[model samples]
Each structure stands twice: as C-alpha cells, then as structure tokens.
Target: MSIRTVLLHAAPDSGFNDRLAFAVALARQSGAAIKGLYTLYPAGVPRVGRALSIYVNELVREAKEKEGGLKAQFEQATAAAGLAASWETIEGEVASSLREAVAFADITVVSETPYGTVDDQLAATLPEHLAMACNGPVAVVPTGKPVPARIGKVLIAWKPSREAGHAVRFALPVLAAADEVEVFTVEEGDTTTADSGAKLAAWLATHGVNAKHRHVAEGNAGHAITNEVQKFGADLLVMGAYSRSRFAEMVLGGVTASLLVDPPVALLIAH
Candidate 1:
C-alpha cells in the first residue's frame, strides 16, 4: 500500500531523534503525513506514603516536560522537511497506545533499542510487538548512527511463509522506490530443487521493481541475512517479524529476535 501517514515514536533521546529524522526522510520521499506519538508511563504511587507520592509526582512532572520538549523537536524536524505532521501524548502503556495509533497509520517507525528507561519491559520487545499488533509495517531504525538521507538499496529476506508474504506486500511501496533490491532465500542443506526468489522477483517486476534473486545454503538464517545486508550495503532490510511463536523464539533464539537486538540496517518488518 502507498504510505500516506507515518507513525513515529517520539522521545527525548538521541535514538528517538534519529528515528524522527528517519521518519522525516521517508515522509519527504512519499509525501506522507507524520504522527508523533509519546506515551507516558508514570511511576505508580501508593496511598500509604506521602514522601513516595511526592517523589512519583515529581517524576511525572519531569516526564511531562520531556514530552513537551520532544514534541517541539518532532515539529521542527517535520516542518523543516515540509511535511504535514501531528503529535499525540497518551498516558498509558506504550504498546497499547501505539496499537491504537497504528490503526490509522500506514507505517510505524521506532528505534531498534530501548528509547527511555533502559529497564523498561515494554521497550525490550517493542519492534516485534508493534509488528504483531498492527497490520501495517514497522520500521526499526538502527542505533548509534545517522540514518541515510535516502533508502537506496533494499534487501528482502524471502521465506515461503504467510508472514513473509505479508511483509513483502506491505513493503511494496519502499521496494518500488529503492534503487536496488535483492530477494534472497536461504536453504539449510544442499537442496537446489526450488527457487522461490526468482518467482518473487518476477512478480515484483509487474510492480515496476527491478529486483535480483539469489539462493544461499546456510544453516543459520539470521547470520546469512545479516551478511547479505553488509555485503550489499543495504539501506533497508525488509522481512517478516516472526515466523514461529514468540515464546518459542524467545527460548530457541529465532531470526527476528537476533536481528531486532542489533539490526544492521533499517528494518521494515510485518507479521
């Protein structure tokens, strides 16, 4: 689908600023409106202690000030890019708040790592949760580096699954805009009987996307995908969020978990 509106998670941190820049760049490219979301999770207060209540109130006040500052930053970035934008501040859980906002957004952008409160349980699995919570795609911006001014090269991790197809279809707009696209599938053993990449490439051609396909025999899918991203110098990586159950992935360490931990490039993921 065409990206008409982008939902961005705004915060008072370098990672969030980077994500805002990334979202602004995308909005400039697609002429999409920007919606900056800031969800506040105030510290819980008890009725028994006056001192603790005062401390919690102070923390909440500080958080509100930070949110106001972040809203200004988001506005500056979006206005500089000459994009239509809006901001929302909700007092609730991050995931649930974003889930409601994502319903109206075409694409959602977030930081690859935790944005605030390093020990935040919700931030820990944010990207995956966002992907699973919404029908749209989630763009996870990598940390510690400036996002590219343009997304030139895109790498598609093609696995024949419903989730993978959903990601590809949702990311069609980005794939068509990218200068280069590589659709690759990995095989665990030396089985050269099927080549789904070529078929997928042919389909993408109908959408005016010139893509190349390749097959790799690798035991570890996540490692192979990351290696390809590095070798190709991809600006964005598009793939499914999680093929297996989240619980199983947590214990067995799936591709989604590994990549989300340290994404090599901007990750566009869908469930």
Candidate 2:
C-alpha cells in the first residue's frame, strides 16, 4: 500500500533528467529508496576483420562512457534530494532488463516514448511493456515535461475490471494524499451499470479518498478519458494498461495505446 522502493529507468536521452527528477521527488515524498537502473547495449562481436572488431570496441567504450555520466547525474540528483538511492547497470536489451528490474520495486517511473517511427522498439513500448511485466504499478512521466510541483488532483479511468481495480488499489497511497480525485467511466451501452462509477467512488471513500464520480457518454474510450483529464485539470491519471493483448492493442488502438501515444498528464498504469 505504501511506496517503499521506486525503480527509475536511467538512460542517456533527452527525457532522462526529467524522469529522474520526478522519481527523486516521489521518493522524497514517500521516504522510499530510489533505484536507478540503466541498460547497457550488448557489445557485439565482429567476425570480418580486426578493423571491424576495433570499431565495435570503440562503440562499446563510448556507451560505457555515456553510462558513467548518466550514473553520476543520477547519484548527484538523489544526493541533492537527500534520498537513499542505489544504481545498477544491466547488459542486455533495454525492455527485458527493465522487466527483470521491476520485480523488486513497488513502483516504476519511466518517460513517455517519443512519438515517431517504431524503429526503436524498446523506446516505443517500454512503458507499456513495463506496465504488463512490473506486476505492481508504472508511473510514466511525459517526455520533455518536468514533474509537477504537486499531484493534488488525480483522474481515475474506471472500467469495472480486475485490472482497473488493481490499478486503483495500487494507487491508493497517492489517492489518499491527493486533495481531489475524480473517478470517470465511459458507458458503451447497458454493458455497464449506471452506478459503476459511483461504486468505485464509494470504495475509495472507505480509504479516505472522497472521489467524485462522472459517467460519460458512449464513444471512443481514449478520447473520453483525455477529455475528462483536461476538464478536471488532473496532474495525474491512473488507469489499467493493456486490457487486451499488446498485439491487439497495437493494431486495434485501445485506451492504453492512446495514452501511451500521447499522454495528457503523468500516468500511473498497472496491468
């Protein structure tokens, strides 16, 4: 129920600093330990010639140098924040390494994937993949945006499913601390009861979170959720990820896909 350890993915990229700062702030707020995890690109072997081998070695060296710099930045930031932290480097594919690292963490903080071509598979899908594999919760910070000073208002995309219920429970610590929380559900027909959203709000009330329930008209689930986020001025949006399979989501375009593609705010997702 409490955040005791926060796992942050550290990379030598544009959004790394913002993600690290956000993770550090969350750790400071919850008095949790921060674990900085970096995945090093696996060194490749050259079978052609000595020159190619030398080039490969050079690439590996440059990667290590960059990793060292990133580690230093992470350490300095955590120190400045006065939070207990640790760092580790994994040698393998980024997503796989992150999935393994999330096992020991209560929550994982990652940057939103840059919108573009899917040339970089890991970067494009890391957050979603982590949400599925982490078994806890993954907090995704939007790329190029600094963490908000306060997460006072939160929007919960309620869908009356085991996954959504898990997400709400996993985010209880944050919800309990928020000044205001709204639980919104989009009705696709009579498939969902009229009081479904209110039921979630009532459950949250038991945990001391006085949440307002809103029922939205049937439409695109993703757009409806985003509209609610904008209307409520929510600093954080909590929801379940991949109610469908990843392949299905990728092709069919579900709420998970929409949020990952263009997150309206910081998102806390669980699967």
Clashes of each: 0, 0
Q: Whole-model lDDT for model 1 versus the true structure?
A: 0.83
What TM-score does each of the candidates earn?
A: 0.90, 0.88
Compared with the true structure, what per-residue lDDT tens digits does model 1 show for residues 178-238?
9999997898663641377788999999999999997887669899999999899898899
lDDT of each model, Cα atoms only?
0.83, 0.82
| RMSD to true structure for each model, in Å | 2.9, 3.2
> Which stretches in model 1 have alpha-carbon errors above 4 Å?
42-58, 114-122, 190-194
Q: Which one is best on lDDT?
A: 1
208-240 in candidate 2: lDDT tens per residue? 999999887788888989988899999899998
Candidate 1 scores a C-alpha RMSD against the true structure in Å of 2.9
Report the poorest 10 consecutive residues by lDDT, candidate 1.
Answer: 39-48
